[model samples]
Target: MTPTPHDLPADLDVFLAAAGWAGATVEPLQGDASFRRYFRVRKPGDKTAMLMDAPPPNEDPGPFLRAARWLDANGMRAPHILADDAARGLVLLEDFGTARMRDYLDQWPDDETAIYTAAVDALVRLHDLPPGPFLNYSMSEYQREARLFTDWYCTARDLYVDAGGFSAAWEAVLGDLLPRQRPGVTVLRDYHAENIMLLGALEKQGLLDFQDALVGHPAYDMVSLLQDARRDVPPELEARMIDHYVRAAGVDKDTFLADYARLGAQRNAKIVGIFVRLWRRDGKPRYLELIPRVWALLERDLAHPALAPVAAWFDANVPTALRESLGGRFEA
Candidate 1:
């Protein structure tokens, strides 16, 4: 199926018309496996607007909308929803330009500390969102997502771990995790270097990919930051950030460590699966290149007693040949 503009579902035009975001060149922005298409619409004498076209009946923008609102109210900066048509599954948002946080990190590596600290502060605000009927980021969801490593990544690469091996490891790790998730906190489920913006003190300080936000482990976002699949933050830098986040969040030392270990494992599991899915389903091989850094980070984090079971499992059963292949790809 060669996808084209006409294939952009019919409601997009109607949404552009209703929102007065016309005559702008709508070019697709790269995104994950969602019907979401971001168009950099540049019109004559008009402030740039990012037309978020997530076609309806397949995908819903409700969570994205609600999360954006929540972030805005909580003193974090996600793009303001300029216009919304839930039925049409389209949203027009204030464009913050293309300066993503990753771009800044690449350009000015020395500015990492300040940029990351600022992002973490904003994250603190986001996580401070008061409890509500918003769905819980329960262990079950994490387990389900964690399984993606095998189902997608391993499977896509013709790699496999026996059921006994997989189950034995996951069960032990999860048992440890159950106790650690005691004082739950909101999780941005997918907060990473890429999801953030580099526009410091500008209009949109951060761009939110908060559609997957959930109430879960507090350490989740921290894990996302340190164990980023796309880029490897040095271990020393990661430790500093860990301390910064824990202190800023006002959590106890032991409590933060336990949860951090658990969340780190959870984050690694999710990314392993996601990378595989991106490759197999979306044909995105770029993620494969990052696999080694991710695995190395996971290996380092899993050195904690909390993740010993999982660490050993990968050590024993996930296969050296497979690890060598994935690890080498990531290193390159």
Candidate 2:
């Protein structure tokens, strides 16, 4: 039987006691798009830790634990796992504190350049390590993800698009690129600002929500950081960060730039479908408000010659007016 929210606290208490955190005061933390829940556990003597309640069936703690171990062993700043009960889906983790990269940048906009540069540098370092024990971010996976646009967004907008053509377009674009990404680096699929924590200085970026990590192109995480759906990264800043990574990693500028653009379009398209699904299927309408921003990013990405096949598909199917008018429509 699935555990409801009401029974979760009781289960958490049992897990906490078994883990020797019996009386830790638990304060609920804001959850993400997934079914997992988090709580800030506090006890006397200034002890504090994060409680991840990723209940079984709907969610699992295995991937998160595996990824966390790999990252921590690699000298990256994934939160330290203090205790874990994977069966019940409870994990006690070291608290990274309240300064998320998104919130921090909002408070001090002047620090944007420095922080983003550090984020790019972090990716540079991450890519240097061998790929983690995860599935390859293969052509089929890319096609499947890109099809989310046609699956959810197009359906929500009542657009009759050629789903097969959509998959074919992605294949044509991403086919040759796959060879360049062989033995690829670990791509933290969700490497945006909200999932990153500012630990202290620019060098200490704490990673979060990386359970879905995959071995993919180095450029993929760079796109995730710069072409964020939740926040607008300045165009000039985005370009500079791209250059920073290319120079630091010593990759050919033109090739990396092309891959970056292609991945950006693909990622943005997937996000469009995900946001729409969040509303239509999950009954969370606020995600729809971000569609316009994602559309703008997608338009920018589609301008690249590398994304022409997919771009052509969009042009013939998704009309400009329909894309622009997504604001305030789904909310109703």
Candidate 3:
């Protein structure tokens, strides 16, 4: 299902020609589990640009294009949209280069703290930005995303859906919990290691795959960064990072911890299901390898006792084999 560079539309030739360019070469860029495809472009005497080959009909570049403009105006760095055909679903972008935070972590282990700290700070700034129409991610939206866990993790895997109570309980919890969150700023839904690029000592951060941003809790992005499933951000370091945010935000510890735990648990549950869907639907089983770490994070945040019922439900009904496969017992 992955499309190659050769699959690009003939419009590419016209666009390149219109720009008065010569001797352009295209190289397939890194991919993610989405309808979009990217390629790096090489043009003489200029900085690099990216070619977006979004699949027709199924995916639209409207959201991304609008978001890019919104972010650019708001002191954020989203790729500028150069050209586009709404019907064809293609657009050119400012290339953010090929350095992923995951790869960056692979190269420099010692700089983990600094890099993650920078990302956290970036997240805080995004969250604190003035509100806009595009920023809205209301309760209905939260319910929809949270439902992914039940759909994929519970139903697709057929592992456990305890007592018919899980659904109602989760819904009830959201009904009560969601109102507590203060929302307004933009949330780059996937702010983890993969979407961010460490561009040369993090001076100019490279942001990609940010079309799904929503207006949600400020703590939500922080939870995504500190409790990333893809990479190992040490527990001690994560704690310190949270503390740093607390100091920066100038909020009370108890209030911040409660929101952090609630949203962290919420995000991780969604990710557990997301990885399941990635494996089952997208044929990307490698993501399944991180399920355990995400589950471990889920358990840690669930220990707050607010999630006691949800924790107990998982304990009684979820299969031991699945627990093992995902990454051992919660107690472990």
Candidate 4:
């Protein structure tokens, strides 16, 4: 069942009272693509905090709490957890204010390069840290994610694709990369513009929506940032940021660039399927609008020689007409 604000726990007030905000004004905020919902808690004296209601059976606050603590402890800017009730699935977190990187960029387009530079710096800092306590982003995981394109996307488009070939192609492409991911850095799977909050300075990028963090290749998060699904990051800027990260992290340029394209293709494919599922199954058609942009990014990723096998699979299955026609066909 999809939870609404009215479906909030009965003891929510009691939980707030226990947390020393007995009568705070709780204003519901817009939700993301999950069962979890957030509320802005404001009290007398202009005090503020964010409340996350991740109800049980469908959602869990454990991973979010664990990741939050780990990021905060490691000198990162994840929101501070003020209070939590794991059994009830409620948490009080520090409010990082209203300056989201996505919105900020929209207002100040001239600051794009500088802001992206800081974001790249943040990734370098994070990759420098030892691996966090998280599940490994193994080859099986990559395969499972990539298969979503065939499973949901092809099915939704009423196109009969070779699902087995899709799997084999991804396996061939990602096989060599998996060996490099041993004891990998923490990959905040959804590390993109909207999830990054700008706290005072561009360098102070506060992280969010990171419950699904995994130990994976350093290039995954970089791809997420540069090849953003929700926004149009200029190709020139993306190239510059890749150069910046390669220099800052002291990694082999050729290997990292290949891995970046590989991971970008994998992630973009997964997102295309997820958006379709969100619309067809979850009744959220707005996500369908993002498919065209994602397809463009995915095509760019497929241009790399590292993704030749997967590229062949796409060429043989998902034709150019269907790719370009998504916007007209899937309108909400």
Q: lDDT for each of the candidates?
A: 0.72, 0.89, 0.74, 0.91
Task: State the lDDT of candidate 2 residue by residue for 171-230, as single tens digits.
Answer: 999997999899899999999999999998889999999999999999999999999999
User: How many clashes (backbone atoms < 3 Å, residues ≥3 apart in a chain or on different chains) does model 3 have?
Assistant: 1
RMSD (CA, angstroms), candidate 2 = 2.6
Alpha-carbon RMSD, each predicted model: 3.3, 2.6, 3.6, 2.3
Over 4 Å off, model 1: 1-11, 157-160, 179-183, 202-204, 324-332
Tens-place lDDT per residue, model 4, 120-230, is 899999999999999999888999999888888888878899999999999999998998888799999999999999999988999999999999999999999999999
lDDT tens string, model 3, 1-332? 33354676666777766654445776676677777878777787665678887877778887888778888888777777777775777787877776878888899889888888888777766666775457466666765666677788777665556536665555655555665555556777787888887766674566777788777667788887889888878989988998988887777777778777777877888888888788788888877778889988887887786666666766776776776566442221
Residue 82 in candidate 3 has what lDDT?
71
lDDT of 3: 0.74
- Of models 3 and 4, which has the larger lDDT? 4
TM-score, each model?
0.87, 0.96, 0.88, 0.96
Q: What lDDT is reached at residue 168 by model 2?
A: 90
Tens digit of per-residue lDDT, candidate 1, span 1-332: 33477856575666777778655556677776566877766677766888777777768898889988877776767888889987777788878777888887798899888877877776676667674236876656766877887787666556657646765676777666566544456677778778887665623457667787777666777888777888778878877887888888887877678668767876786777777677767777777766777777666667788777777878865777766564445321
* Candidate 3: segments with Cα more than 4 A from true spot: 1-6, 19-22, 160-164, 201-203, 324-332
